[model samples]
Target: MYDYDQVTAFLGKWGPFQRLIFFLLSASIIPNGFNGLSAVFLAGTPEHRCRVPASANLSSEWLNNSIPLEERDGRQVLSRCRRYRLEALAHFSATNLEPGRDVNLSQVEQEKCLDGWEYSREPYLSTIVSEWDLVCDNDWKSPLTTSLFFVGVLFGSFISGQLSDKFGRKNVLFLTMGIQTGFGFLQIFSTSWEMFSILFLIVGMGQISNYVAAFVLGTEILGKSIRIVYCTLGVCIFYAFGYMLLPLCAYFIREWRMLLLALTVPGLLYIPLWWFIPESPRWLLAQGRVQEAEDIIRKAAEKNHVTAPDVIFDPIKVQDLNSQEQQTYSILDLVRTRNIRSITIMCVILWMVISIGYFGLSLDTPNLHGNVYINCFLSAVIEVPAYTISWLLLQYLPRRYSMAAVLFLGGCVLLFIQLVPTYLSVVSITLMMIGKFGITSSFSMVYVYTAELYPTVVRNMGVGASSMASRFGSILSPYFVYLGAYDRFLPYILMGSLTVLTGILTLFLPESYGAPLPDTIEQMLRVKGIKYRSASKSQRRLKYGEENSVILKNTSL
Candidate 1:
């Protein structure tokens, strides 16, 4: 078994570079956060000031004359007054009067004393309605765009995975980062909603590549024992930065466009990734590029000032390489095996439920309180504790139990919000926020868990499919809000039930705690019964050299 000390040493030596990769990866996806929340600023009612004609009489007689006496109470008084005022004023023709001539008394007075009601309303309502031509215009189009973007992400993931497999993870990362940065900036300059949606899709496509490449590279570079910890921690810190930066962006740039521009600016900084990040040696060897792999190994050895030994990189001979196959896996391969199919179904369902509930709740931040900024900040603030707890729980609890408990707790909290009275809605929202934290934490855990379940060759594909499914949930979430589900917390009820069910379902998956990463489906199936092949005695001695000399000396003695 791999020891924690060895993993820590490896991370200590290479952790900075690993952190850098994750940072860039996280920055590239910040636009997702923007897209996720931009509706609050973009689609809300705008404040407008309009004046009513002054000559119009809004007195008791007008109300009494226009409306039946029985209907002339407080509720109908305003409507009756407006109707009579408009009717009485219609006979006068002010436009026909000569220039400088005295206008009619009704026209002059009505113009002077404006009494009409004016309130803020959504500005782009007509345009949005005409564009989609839907019954309601509750920003469903934005999530539609989001959904398309995720579809693009599915394609991008596959393409980027192939490119990373063929060329290298680092180069793909740099290229994808550059593309994401460019398109993300272009989103700021988008003139129309269509243009913005299109650009968002493009940005999402490229963003997926950055995430897939960085994750694969990080996992490949790390030692086996701590891979899950590093991957999870990397994402946790990324979200921590996201929560910190998103609020700052919201504060500095009140306009949604300006905020998006600010988010895009950081992506440009990742361009230097071309020079700093290195290709994964494991990938090179998997592709039969032994010379290239050895060269990379030599550079890493040089950087650490460790000597390299000559060895033939044969897949069949090396225990680590034994599972390497030349064939590339496709989406269909995910469902080809019963076990992979089960994992895929479970992951997809979990992803969909988490995303729908998590994002639906987060997006309701504007409706939760008067001060959207404060509410959004508070919501993000809660995530910090959730992540901290997740880190601790993941270390101690079985993966299934941890995932289940969080999901169930989150669901219960969401359900509890519904029974509370409107006066206590804030308390309910706070509970919902805590639930959001739990769901978000569970969402992050799914990534690590899924990665652990799938082999290296098909890992990205499996994750990519889950990403696509989650986006589908995002697409459907807007409709939940559109249907006034958020108004009475019905969405929360549905999401909560689904989450609890997902938690129960998680109990069935085989525990991967302390297990070696299975490099093939066959290996994954035989995890308990079949012992993993180990490196030969001579090979181990040759690889370790003087570092293991003490152990060898002790054994000999």
Candidate 2:
């Protein structure tokens, strides 16, 4: 409804109905955090070496020497793929009775694990890497698994909007939840990497679909004042809760399958939400299901102990009061003017860089040189403060400089991690966490700042294009994390370099602290602080039919 306030004014805000939608929708977002990052533990590669069977009858010295050591991080460690030729170890030369002490290991011929491999069980009982033997030359497969999921996410974003309008938001929301849960559980039974990857892709699709659906639904149902809270603290914070729970679950259940199973079963609890969470009354009204919309609104009014007007919305008035010819805008519109073009380019780069940094830091948890569980938990827990601080900054600070400062802070600390001694892993992890905090805050702030930068004609299109750029960033994120296999600091260095570059670019953007939203490119480029200087608050209020678009900026990760 263009005039939804007319209805919500009687329905009242913060009442039982709004409360239910707020908490239930927020709770529904919890699984996404775990689902998104579960790959960190599920695909974790444990320390492994060639498995020398007892049937070889090699002596203790020979058995110990069977697996060769390689230099990594300035220290020798057991080779994951290469080993001393077992044939030579089984039949030692008469001149050299003991290996390593007498014979130089460098002279020994090395070969791939001929007998298979044995993995260390100190941290993980099993992971997909161990199960599928996705190590050695195939180590890239581990990160590829995470990237494929985001590929599914990219496809999901393409279709979710059309599907949401085709089917009701509530319908698609629960349907996606079911898909996430069902596929998540089914993933444990995957016999090969191919099967798990396929299921994971579909689950990724559902994960994002529901998140978008829930976000849109909340915007439609919640009153104007509460929608912002629902967008920021409600959905985002609960996602952190689920993220926090993931490490705790993985800690107790070291086996990847068990951890995966434990993380997915909670979806069943949200199944009952179908009854408690109603369809968006506004969607029903738009669909011309006015009776249905009225029914939901009436229920809400009664639930809130408020009186509803005898006739909430007249059908004739709805059709005649605010009807206008719809205007269409495409990606081309974003670059139609000089200001819009510059803004679009900058916003896309910023959004993509933020996605890469955030997901890169998250997937790097296992490689943080400490207890993976604790590191993962710390990574998840920090988001709460990151979000709170972001909310505070957006309220008081100028949008342009605050975003640049956080990105600079995050990037600089990540680069500093390279300066610290590798042995001082605590310092490295601490710096990495600070980087996550900055990226996370930037991630939240970018949506608000970028949306304001665009004219209304292409506002949604501007954000959509930027968000699509972000999906590509996320798809490439695991590979950035994969760089850690070569050097522990490599991923951070790459992300930091890009992040710092993006931060520098942020300085070019015009400040939008209190500027009224521009409806056209000329308006957007107009001199600051003209008529809008004083009327900014009233002029910036969300207009009818526009509040629903806020969901377009929902942070899916």
Candidate 3:
């Protein structure tokens, strides 16, 4: 097994730099929050109106004759009749004015007369049938475009994760950022529905890589003590920050395309990631490139004004043997083990439930009765407190209990939304938003918990696969929104039941609060709670020697 003390000592020596990198990687995900609002801009069709100029010779008799006296009262009625007659004359003159002909109007003068009356009305001309109409244009085009973007993300995660492992995290980060920036800029110039769909897909492809790299790189560089917090809560904070920024964009940028362009601008700043971000040393060692890993470590030590230790690199010492011994982790491996199998099954069900209900609720937000802007704003605002609740509960309660409570509460809230009368729709939405907050928190917790359950080698692969599965829920969300044809509550009923079922599954998962992170399949399979099953007598002695060496090294430093 790898020496935890040595790793801890190394982390303590270099923790500050890791923390800084974590913050930057977290900041990188902020732009994705605005994606929820992208449809609003893509479908906007604002109307413009111009009025005709007033004419002095307009007849009042015709307009007065048009108005019925029973609908009129005294001077107020007479004044309205006279004003209407003059406005009618202006409308006629503006439409029919002859330039340089019988009329004395020049082309310029005629145009001015057309602009003469007051500006009348300017309204958005787009169709508004359901709540989805206000949220996004309910055309086949916008939904298809949005779905294509998620599809890109599904593929991009797998591609990016592998590339990061092969090349290095920093390079992938820089490359993905550059690609995302380019695609984001292209999305602004998309004129037709087809063009926008294609651009968004490209954008999603670029964007997915960055997030996967950021999460992996952040966790790899940090100490185990703070790894979960830095990766999970840290990532969640950035996501929430992105959510908060969406409303600000809505308020400032009225034009949809302009708003998208504005959102894309910040991503360009991430280009400098090439120079600042470094490759993960742990990853290098795992690939048996010890010299390169040592060099990187030496450079980091130099930057921190600390001298490099005189030590020989050993592949056997560095490799996470527990992970290597497993060789292959199949679906059967997940279930064949007792505690592990139960955990895997629970995780899968929870992933499905949270994915469906969380996204289902979010997708339906536009249909909720209220100003779309205010409703979105409130929903985002509530997430801050939701995060706080997550932080608090995670510290006090066992992971499963906290997850179950939150999910059950979320389900109850969804049921409440369905049962509430239409007149009390606002109250129902408010409760639904609270439920959404709980579910989102639960979703974040699951990501953290999954990392702790498995050993290191399969960590990225397992998380990536599970995340991709959860994304299926996101993929189905737009279709559910479109399914308002049958009944608006149909999606809600399905999503709510799934969440409750997930909560029940949470009971099956074992508590992992103080358990050592399983390094190998043998350690994972120790159902009798036996200790050190994988290590031989000689290996145990070597482990003690390494622990002593790590203690001596730390003290000398």
Candidate 4:
């Protein structure tokens, strides 16, 4: 049977048709970047204090002084969750008050704020925190919202692949895009935190579903040479650029509702793209819609100014199509075989580490040592170079080596952060960015490596399972950030340790570089040579050393 890549070579390779699809699909990812991390700014808690009532008739000095000081981490600070019982204090004055002689200030009764809280308006004019008093006792709600979003992503990852395969990639792509855009807009009018969180969950499902559909579609439609570029530079880079735009958007649009609205409005730009992009030809062929697939191939050839054959997939025998349709697979298949089970487990762990480290650092931007806007922008910007470098390494190194190297390096940088002096914040932040760059590069490599590891029958299932693990890790990321209250370096310490462990585990997976994608459980476990289908003797492959020896032998002759 002819592989999709071989058939695609005739249609076009890195041509105008392919370029348009790549850009349009990648562009749709920008809104996802914004909505995914919007929680950082939208739910950020500003410096706040318990609200004091004016009915107490206390002087300006007395009113400001009413909130008593408490010792925390060796520093005196005003109480945020509690205030003095003002009825008795209203009668007292500076003349009558003395720390020890007249009244012991520490003996004053304190109670939780009866009237709401006052928030600082410096970084944000409005946020979920200020709008609903989600501070102090309610602070837990902020992280919970972010976690709920990823819960939706977990469900979406499990379902989107099956839906895209049953229907068509293009239809699923558009449907998810609509879901993302519609729910995002709905969030602006939310009457309560519960309503906003529910909408955000639906939007989260749409976001991941949209991204997965685009990724699978691009991989199927583009030529082999261009597929890696599409995944890394085209998809990941565009997503990173959108992430960079987020903080800048938030910096100007200080109101949380308007900021969210601004991020969502970009989804409208993708609507016109529906006319320009076509369904994946490979998927069409799989569904036995040969005419529709052929038409798309011909259109691609015409746009690329190349002459295409009368029937691009003419070599596919009837038996081959039947074989594909007859073959059945399930989640059980992933673990039913020893080799596949090992591969699936390792990929899951690696993906989980990447998610926690990547998002743990990303969502913890406010805690970093710099202006939050600049820190976030820099964090997003760093991924661009990391992804580019990943593409370059993919061309030169084995998949396992490149992935493990980056993961290990990222972990080291994260761990080393603990040694940096607190006053030398610039050094610390730079190291954090470097650590991010490493993990980001590994993230790009993992997607490509995962696809190549699994056989065609279970490829979608394998990637989807790995993605679900990633979403699970992302769900845990907010809690990781929340740990900073005990100690600022705690999140980094935990993320770093796990990343290092995953990096080591990544080394155990068989190298996919210069190797065939196994089509059966037997082939996956036993076959270690060749770069194509190994079911036939003609497809037998020579090792790298053997190929080198062959060249030397020919030269000597």
Candidate 5:
């Protein structure tokens, strides 16, 4: 019986139908990119000091003296959270009016800011921090806000996968797009941090759920030759494109609310695309709706301008699928088998480490030396070449080596950042970007490698499990960058050390480059001792014994 790829081959690759699907699906990803990192600009904290109240009755001459100066980084700056007692300062001024006298300034008592704080507005006109007065005692709220968004993401990832399988992919995709856009709009009008956090959680759920819907739809429908490009260049590059657009948006629209409103406008454009894209035919076939699946395939053929045979989907293949015993697998199954269990544990660790390092560096872009706008933009810009380099490596290098080498290189660069002289911050920034490039490549490669490593029965679950581990990493990422408050190099040291160790762990996984996708866990175990190479048509037919199932090339997840 002919398979889905065979049906796709008959329709022709790169046709009008395929182009529409790719364009619309890819366009949907751009808004997710903007919302995912909007926290960088929205929660920015600027230089600030205690606000001296009018009741202090201080003249311009006494204004500077109202707030006590403390040593910070070997230089004196006004204390951010404290001010001198007004009565003591007034008495000191009245008693010792002479300049340069031994007034014993240390005797002045300090107190917490009674009035609100004054913020420097040059970098940001306003942010969540400045607007809500989330400073000093409330400073912990900023990172917690970012982490809470990812906590929303964590829950979203868990339920979205199962929901997509039950509901149609197209329906869920559209639903998530609406959820993301609607909640994003609500974030602009939030009156309190609590209100914004709840809205942000809903938006987070929509963010990952939307991505999963698009990813699965693209992987299942596109032709085999074009599937890799769709997953890598089609989906990922557009995400980077949206990322590159983020700093530009934030640069011009300096106000946090307006910037969020601006970022969310693009998602509204995607609502119309619902009419242009089709539901996944593979999903229809899996549900035993062969006639509906065939109808869509025929529609694709018509749009591709190819003539399709009257008999499109083979009945025998559908019957075989229906007749096959339904087997159930769970997360425990991943750890139940000995060999699969080992691979699963390693993958989970690898994903978690990669995510923490990737996101830690991404969120820390604002802290890097230079203009925050330029630094954030450069952080996004570096991914362009990194993706290009990754594309080249996927063609020539083994998956295990390429993944490990990039991780190790990125880790080494991060470790070296600690040694750069503090004055040479530009040098340090450059090294961090280099490390980001390496981690970016590893991040891109891991999705494909993990998909290839797992069998068909548990492929979605395996990828989902690893992705869930990644959410935990993302939840912790803000805190990792938060470590900079204690010491500038702490974030880098932790990220680098974890990356280096995980890089070594990656070497033990079997190489998937040029390998056939295993259909079962037993087949995957046998692959360890096997040498995989590209095969001719005759060899593929002989290998799979062409009674029905086809030996197709592996596609990226």
Candidate 6:
């Protein structure tokens, strides 16, 4: 049977139809750039201390002393979670002698904040922490909120592939887009943290789901040559566009609710894209809807002002499409062979560590000493070059070496951050941004490299498991950022160490650049780079009707 690409060769690779799909689908990814990182501003913890009550009956001088001083990062500052017992201080004021010199000020009792906190309005006028009072004993809740969203991302990553496969990519793409846009809008009116968290989870589910759909849709529709560019520069650069826009929006919109609102409204304009972007013909043909697939190609040919073959799909019998259905493989198949198992495990570790550095560094921006807005914007802006460099590395360098190099670079830079003086914030911020750049570049490389590492039969499932692992990394990342509260260098030290470890692990995996991708586990054994381990029972191939029973799972799930 003729392949789908051969049948549709008349439409050409870079025609008007492909360009439209490329831009519109890439355009859809813009919202994810900001939405994914919105928590940096939305959940920001501003400088705050215990609020003093007017009834304390203290003058301005005594009022300034209401808050007890505590040591933080080796500096004396007003305590955030505790204060001098205001009534005790009021009573002490009655004595003629000053408390510190005449009486022992240490004798004054310190207590947990009974009154609310007073947060500095700079940077963010209102954040979720300020609005909901998620500080002191409740301070842990702030990072938990970010973790819950990633929990939603985990669920979404696991299921979106299955949903997209069963229902078709276009359907899942638009459906998730609706879920993301609708839930994001609803979050604006949340009266309590519970309500907001529930909605944000749904938004997270939608956010990654739509991104997966658009990514799959574009890659499937465009020709093999353009797919690389779309994946590297096209998709990544546009996402950077949205990321660069995030700080700009946050800078202008000081309120958390308004920042969310600004980030979500752009999704509405993408509604019209449903009409413009056609269902992928490759997906249609796989579904055994030959005529629908041909019709789409016909329309694409018209858009490109070219002629398609009169019977482009006739060579592909409807029955041949069922072959993909017969070759079902599950996640277990990943470890069924030595070469594939090693690849899968390595990919998972690399993906998880990349996510740890990616999100950990991103969320830690607010804690960086320089201007938070500039720090975040520069973080986003650096991705353009990182992605471009990743594309170059993909074209010119060995996949394993490139992946390891970026990981090592990012890890080393982060590891060095602890050595910089805290007062040299410019130096510290520069190191952090450099770490972000290396990780960001590694992030793109892993996506492409993982796709190349797996055989076509179990590619999507392999990537899905890896992506699920990534959510674990993301969920833990906020806590890594939370480590800043305990010691500023802890998050960097941990993420950097893990990243460097993964880089060393990448060296053991077979390189994929300039090599034919394995189509089956049998095919992988013959590939040049894989150094086979001692064969075991699991690696033995079954030689019976049971082999035929293993159905091939769909790709890019």
Q: Rate the local accuracy (lDDT) of all candidates.
A: 0.64, 0.88, 0.64, 0.85, 0.86, 0.87
Candidate 3 is scored at a TM of 0.72
lDDT of 5 by residue, 363-479 (tens): 999888789999888888888788877877887899999999999999999999989986898999999999999999999889999999998889878998899899999999999
Global fold similarity of model 2 (TM-score): 0.92
Poorest stretch of ten by lDDT in candidate 4: 525-534
- Model 2 Cα lDDT, one tens digit per residue, 1-557: 35777656977778988998899999999999999999989999898988888887788767777777778878988888988777777668434477767777789888887777899997999999999899887888898999999998998898888899989999999999999999999998999999999999999999999999999999889988898788878888999999999999998999999899999999999988999999988777777787898888889888999898898878876665446566877778888765677777788899999999999999889887889999999999989999998988988999878999999999999999999997888999899999999999999888888888888888878888998999999999999998877887889899999999999989888888988998877788532223333335555575533665655556442
Q: Please report the candidate that would top TM-score against the real structure.
A: 6
Off by over 4 Å in 3: 2-15, 40-138, 287-292, 302-307, 310-326, 335-345, 452-461, 518-557
Off by over 4 Å in 6: 323-325, 525-557
Could you tell me which residue pairs clash in candidate 2?
Answer: none
Residue-level lDDT tens digits of model 1 in 334-353: 88866778888888998888
Rank by lDDT (best first): 2, 6, 5, 4, 3, 1
Worst lDDT run of 10 residues, candidate 2, spans: 526-535
Question: Mind sharing the TM-score for model 5?
Answer: 0.91
Whole-model lDDT for model 2 versus the true structure?
0.88
Clashes of 1: 5
For 1-557, candidate 4 gives per-residue lDDT tens digits of: 56767766766577789888888888888877878898999888787888887777776756867788876534699878888878756766535564345666688888888898988897889998888888788888989999999998988887888899899999999999999999999999998999999998998899999999998898888877788788889999989988988999999999999998898888888888888989988788778787888888888889999998766776356237645655678899999866787788888998998999999999988888779899999999999999999999988899888998999999999999999987889999998999999999998888889988988889878987898889999999999998886688989999999999988888778888988887876666322332443344543344655788999999999
Mark the 10 consecutive residues where model 5 has the least summed lDDT.
Answer: 548-557
How good is model 6 by TM-score?
0.93
Candidate 2 stretches greater than 4 Å from native: 93-96, 321-323, 526-557
| lDDT of model 6, residue 135 | 98
